[model samples]
Target: MHHADLFGPVDAGLPEGLVYRPDFVTAAEEAALIDHVAALPFAPFQFHGFEGNRRTVSFGMEYKFDGSGLKQAEPFPGWLLPVRDHAAALAELKPEDFVHALIIEYAPGAGIGWHRDRPVFGDVVGVSLGAEAPLRFRLKEGSKWRRFTLPAEPRSAYLLRGPARTEWEHSLAPVSALRYSITLRTLRAA
Candidate 1:
């Protein structure tokens, strides 16, 4: 099916500084990326003071979130240079701007909780492979919360900046099939 047909219209109500591009990669490219990810060793995601079901590894910069806060570990793997470049171009960000990548693999029953990316990170861009999942967003209002949902389809890419990156919190629901995401982020300036 055509990528446009798969994603349909972009919602006008989506928060500011959000970009969703479907078919960011061709089927062949997606397949190859999936294979590469499968070959890599993935450890259970350890963050926010607890372990999670999703398995994750990093490139460019490894991220560790102890109970207190997030920290950078080893340098990003050299093998991920191509992917980092591709993601940077797609997001209209400079290659040097992106200094970290967090590759996450989620099983059928796994989903991420609502939360903002660490403040130390700048713009965020992510490529989705293997499965389609709903990416939801929520923002606190006076006494309520406003919400929105976007489908993160296979081969698609999404970018979050400005308010979308800082003020709002995003999450994914339990996926029905295996899904892989390569999330790239720039280091926030001091």
Candidate 2:
């Protein structure tokens, strides 16, 4: 694919600045991921606070993990070696165990509030699948917002690291259909 077609047009950066990768994941891979998750039982989204509180709300199903988090529901035997291991990437920078949160919603008009990943993690990774949704990122405490209108194509991934992870905030707009994201993060050492 041509460089321009792959990334499309370049857009202004967010307040903290951000990097954009249009084809983070291929369409075929995206479909497989969506199908896999769709087969799983839909449960209430779970939440874990920085203070060590764990809770589940009926409105959504969110999973929060610390250190020992795996990308999939069932662990793959030889799962995620250094080649694609996010934790390995983070280990280069900090010593804390990594944490992550994932939420899957099937119905339309469901959305998450505008918020930044807490300072607990050094960086954050967000992957979108099932249907296209518009993602907006704004500078923390700033009124201006930069939006990335991503197509709902399957297997799409976005990595927000460096200053973007540390200084900016992001959120998704309300939409119907199956939408889910796998988030990867690294916590600060105790």
Task: Show model 1 residue runs off by greater than 4 Å.
Answer: 1-12, 67-79
User: Best lDDT goes to which candidate?
Assistant: 1
Give the range where candidate 1 is weakest over 10 consecutive residues by summed lDDT: 3-12
Candidate 1's residue-wise lDDT over 1-190, tens digit each? 7543453433449889899889988898899889988887899998766889899988767666765544555566665666678778877878778888889999999999999998888899989999999998878877766777898999999999999999999999999999999998998878
lDDT of 1 at 13: 93
TM-score of 2: 0.59
Candidate 2 per-residue lDDT, tens place, 1-190, comes to: 6543553443454434354445555677566655654655555544443421111211111234454433334332122222125433433433123334443553567666677766555555555666667676655234543344434334555656776666666667776665666555554456
* TM-score of each model, paired residue for residue: 0.87, 0.59
